[model samples]
Target: MGNTINRRSFLGLAGVGGAIFASGLSGWATAETKPGVANDDFFFVQLSDSHWGFEGPPNPDARGTLQKAVAAVNGLESQPDFIMFTGDLTHTTDDPAERRKRLSEFKKIVADLKVKNTHFMPGEHDAALDYGKAFQEFFGETHYTFDHKGVHFIVLDNVSDPAGSIGDAQLAWLAADLAEQPADARIVVFTHRPLFDLYPQWDWATRDGAKAVALLMPHAHVTVFYGHIHQENHHMTGHIAHHSAKSLIFPLPAPGSQPKRTPLPWDSAYPYRGLGFREVEAQRQETQYKIVELPVRKV
Candidate 1:
């Protein structure tokens, strides 16, 4: 059921910090780095799990909430160089037409982003159906690589399985991709699920992610940014750092925080509860980067 065709043959294109109280549309976080590093630095935004069609006691106005995130990014005094929506652009659906509609509406809404360039990967809800045909129809290939400034970014699709697996074909492609890159190049990976086994009982770990991780282990500078757990988590594999972004929709309980994994209900008294975006600044040192999590606020 997984897409076995070499996605590369078909295709193209395309962190975390503490709480700092701020009045901006989103919370502000800044990363500390050596002096002069910020000179050649660049910043980009990451927003995940908008869940556009979700409706219930957990954030009744899901669509409006996503709009506010867009507005928050637009309101930034200095726009990021680009934006990446890690996954779950729309809530899952059984109807094919409705699925496409949700994806379309999501695109239309995000099209208003002041930053022109945007990259997207698929979450299980977005791609598990029909092997992501609907998502690819509106967006492009699920897995691909591109270069910007100097960093090399690899966007992997692991959501074809509910348990999350990258499969062997993509691994081969990734091996070949890394073979061509300079060893010193800064490599950033993006995916929908945690590539490592964070919590298997809740479907949080990737089935064959260990194999992929093994391949990446040879690389000196590798950092993976992903979303799906719906909360901020930081982990390290060898020299690489893996960071999960907080969701724009609703927050999920921390790994094994409770007996089961469930969405934390939004508190009415607290505005923009458990929703925010991550701003990443690339420092002058190829291996150094800083991240700030900005929570959504009333603009």
Candidate 2:
């Protein structure tokens, strides 16, 4: 199917952020048809930091925000090829039973999505307390890889380790995985923490993410999608691109924008502000991606 997004569908989705087109693996570029290998173009939905059991002043409708997001995705004019929740499916809980309960609740809520080919990863809130023991019981592996169309996707587990490191074992595995791919292969990576040190004082940077970047640097076409900071951020490591998704529960302050990293206060006048998900359109043939951020609710 053609991957062009129609105006009606775009308007109906209620985008809150401007669309970003990443091309040439270095900076933005206009969308143009390039003759090359025949590859299918596809798009996927990215939802993150739901914090399912979270309750407090940061958000008054935390209970309903996630459900609203699911409904929004379901109501899309065209269903995505797949949906990926980058992490923090549930809020942190000290009690193991409560953690399991939150995870179970989150699973039930998202099951209502019209598209069933959904993927998931864990955030520190859901895994750090138990080293992903509870999360693994719900979701499968903490890290794995798969291919769609002509693109190879790598989901790394950085939060499973309390110190926020991808660990030596996963790094070696990543090297092996990259070695199997051609230098010009289209690659996408998903992780909870930023692969580069965005802000170490606030725990936003992964401990050993530099090693993972080194493994990916040699590849010509690589893009990363990650979430944990509860905001949308785009960065580049040499020719590779990294994009962060917004949170579903609440928005956090910008990286090192304040004395401490905390959730921006709930805005009564504008409900669900700074909270939403994103849809990523990937043109495998051209090695280009377009990102559109959608609101949790129509204003």
Indicate the TM-score of model 2: 0.88
Best by the TM-score measure: 2
Best by lDDT: 2
List runs of model 2 lying over 4 Å from the truth. Answer: 1-38, 284-299
Ten-residue region with minimum lDDT total, candidate 2: 24-33
lDDT (10s digit) by residue, model 2, range 44-156: 77888999999978887778878877766777667888989999999998999999999999999999998999999999999998999999999889899988756678999
Which regions of candidate 1 are displaced past 4 Å? 1-39, 285-299
Q: Clashing residue pairs in candidate 2, if any?
A: none
lDDT of each: 0.73, 0.80
Cα lDDT tens digits, model 1, 183-221, are 655678898888899999998889998888898888776
